[model samples]
Target: MSGGILSPLDRAIVRATQEGLPLVERPYHAVAEAVGTTPEEVMARMERLLAAGVIRRIGLVPNHYALGYGFNGMTVWDVADEDIAEAGLLVGNLDFVSHCYHRPRHLPHWPYSLFAMIHAKEKAAADALVASIAQLLGPLSRGHLVLFSSRILKKTGLRL
Candidate 1:
């Protein structure tokens, strides 16, 4: 779970994965060479990491803005405490919703606990999606959209 407990090779793999493997015909081989390991070894270690839950997933993150999805909104919902988990699952299942999670509510000032992300072609489309979610969650549920004004500052793998 922690880098300190991982083997040197595993740590190297983690670092490489975070920084991103080289873009080449044989990406694994390129990564292995950088980390002083063989392609087979890198593949094996990755498999082990996945099996052990050290790595949840390995995949690509496309640029939504480049794909014509210019509106990126972080929608936070104020669902009842007892319904947070169910509501999170429901919201996460939506095709437009990219990420959903639960966080502690900030009372008096802020009361949202569940958060979901939506990327759309325009702000109106994003607002429509939020409206649909409101209809599904009812009056107790309240949300606000935070539109991203600039590019994402950070996007990378976990350090460990």
Candidate 2:
């Protein structure tokens, strides 16, 4: 784990990909070229970094708005603690859901514990998607709300 610290070469690799991996047929090769290493080395280091929890994940963060998915909503659900696991799995597996997970409720003001982000083409479609999740959950779902995004937020990964 290197004492949970990033080595110089590892720092360089992270810097090269902090913004995002280069758009290329071989992204690792591009990262290697940028960091003065080889493709295989980059891949190996990345694997080790991931295993050591230095890097949480490496995946695409598509601009949903640009893709015509203008109605982006984060659906929050008030599912009983006992049914959170089942509810999360049911909502998370929906085709339109991009991500879903459980969170601690903040009490009186905020009671939702399950959150799922959904993207759709229109408001009606987004509402329908939420309804579908409610139907799937049935009695397990206490309440829910879809909070639409107001603006785009800059997304980035670890920075060296």
Candidate 3:
């Protein structure tokens, strides 16, 4: 069985995990040094967190826009409730899909529930990708595309 709320140490670990460890070759070791724990302990706690579903994943964010792939879009889908998960899984696996999630749809006016992002080297490429996704989804899916014009804000890391 799992315990109650997170302990202070565990909270610290979570925060550290989000803010990221030092960028050195031995990043975990640096984190351990800052958190006053051993690298092995940090690794063990991270594993436990994963097992407990406290954290889904640890990943690095690449600056795709800076790499000249500035054309990005959020493609929203109005999919059957039962097929949302299946469609999400299928779309999420696409190489161009950077993020995917489900959101509540407002009736009468809005009907999109599943959202996925497609990033490409140009707007035409992104548009074609969205068209391909729509064709792949076929008659069961309905949606629209919203292209990102500018990056107004950006943030990395999280606070526990």
> On residues 5-49, what C-alpha lDDT tens digit does candidate 1 reach at each position?
788899899888876667799989988998999999999998888
lDDT order of candidates, top first: 2, 1, 3
Per-residue CA lDDT of model 2 for 21-83, tens digit only, reads: 899999999999989999999999999998888888889999998999999999999999999
lDDT of 3 by residue, 1-160 (tens): 1584777777778877786656799988988887899999888888888788787777777677788888877888899898998888888888879899999989988889889888888888888899888887886596665757577246554466
Off by over 4 Å in 1: 1-4, 139-150, 157-160
Least well predicted 10-residue stretch by lDDT in candidate 2: 151-160
Q: What is the C-alpha lDDT of each candidate?
A: 0.81, 0.91, 0.80
Model 2 clash tally, residue pairs: 0
Clashes found in each candidate (C-alpha, N, C closer than 3 A): 0, 0, 0
Q: Which structure among the candidates has the greatest lDDT?
A: 2
- At residue 38, candidate 2 shows an lDDT of 99
lDDT of 2: 0.91
lDDT of 1 at 142: 62
Off by over 4 Å in 2: none
Number of the top candidate by TM-score? 2
Model 2: clashing residue pairs?
none
